[model samples]
Target: MDDPIMKHNVPDTEWFDRSSLRRMLRTYSLVYIKPDVGRKGNGIIRVKRLRAEEFEISYKQTTSLRSRDKVYSAIKELLNPDKEYIIQQGIDLATYRHRPFDVRVVLQKPLGKWRTTLMCAKLAPRRSSVVTNVSKGAKDYNLYRLLKGTDQRLNRSEIIRNLIDVSKQIAQILGSHFPLKILGLDMGIDKRGNIWFIEANTKPDCQGLKKIDRRLYRKYLRAKKIMRNG
Candidate 1:
């Protein structure tokens, strides 16, 4: 999945290793270390290189500032030896009202072809939370309205269009490799307006979309029906 999206300039990501960690941190300055099999942003840690030898690791509600080696040892202790982890270059995501947020693009292939159905923004409840997962106390906002009045380099329409195009591309590429019905794409927009792919879920949670806008949910249902009947 990462390879296919890399051509689209998705942020650099690599399997978690001590060497990769040091290299990525040195290059990106900030990175996210996440469990290979996890959800709702649980067990995800954000690591930042503050200086040549100083680092910071943040998880849940707490952040530990320590030397690079100590930070690595602390993180190593928290990991389950049997489970795998990944290191991803962190994007300085755009914020809405001082809280970081990411766009969720929902694509459904109830019919033969994939179609974009819903787009919304998930905002972190606090600045310290590393993820915008609704289960992590984040709130959903109307994608358009959320971008309204923001000082982003890209206008609202441009951002929406780019997201749709990228989502379609990802779905098409992934569909060729796997049997997929629906996709939930988490996307982040940098301050410079560049969009990056965060992750993709085959079974996406539509609860946020339903709660944020019933109209879109109804439309999604209607589209599903049309696809089924066709």
Candidate 2:
């Protein structure tokens, strides 16, 4: 988020704490709190402002609280004190048939140059689900279908092109600092078709990607082989 160009797509994020949580809730109706070293959407929390004082929070289950202190206490109780957390202003994700989803773009360094290897839509199993993580019961769908056929308000081609470019740029930026060979970026599309940078996984799971696109999955395997044995 330090990059001026990248920060625009990145949501407003802050270290999870009472002050930051209260301040973000004042500006945005929804926010997400997650462990600093978490994956599979485990230990993630969703907070929504229902009224001036009343708030709705969802973790393992949904609950309502009347005060910021109460909300803080409730969330804190669910968190592991040994781990760190961050609060990010949530994106009102684009939905298909009322289920929210996000695009997962994987970029790999094949022969030492960054290129997008695969892209797929991870759809939440149900309407009320918080995270669209497959390990958390989400399903993968064809990205083109979700962006083009289901929704017309968004320019599907443009969104894909932009994210592809952004993903490559991100690989370049972060690769400069770390010896990274691959990056799995979680990109979100809001109800208005605007793209958002949700988060990135250094070691992304590509287990079921072949179910989305065989050719792309093969391309990913080739890249992995080249990077591993080159």
lDDT of 1: 0.84
lDDT of 1 by residue, 1-230 (tens): 45554466477888998898878977988899998888878888898888889988888888889887777788897787888999999998888777888998888887678888888999889877778999989998988888984545557888888889888888888898999878999999887777888989887888658877777788778777886787
Clashing pairs in 1: none
Candidate 2 Cα outliers beyond 4 Å, as residue runs: none
Task: For candidate 2, write residues 109-224 as lDDT tens digits.
Answer: 98889989999999999888989999989999989888865433788888889889888877888899999999999999888878898888999989888989898999999899
Global local distance difference test of model 2 = 0.89
Best by TM-score: 2
TM-scores of the models, in the order given: 0.93, 0.95
TM-score of 2: 0.95
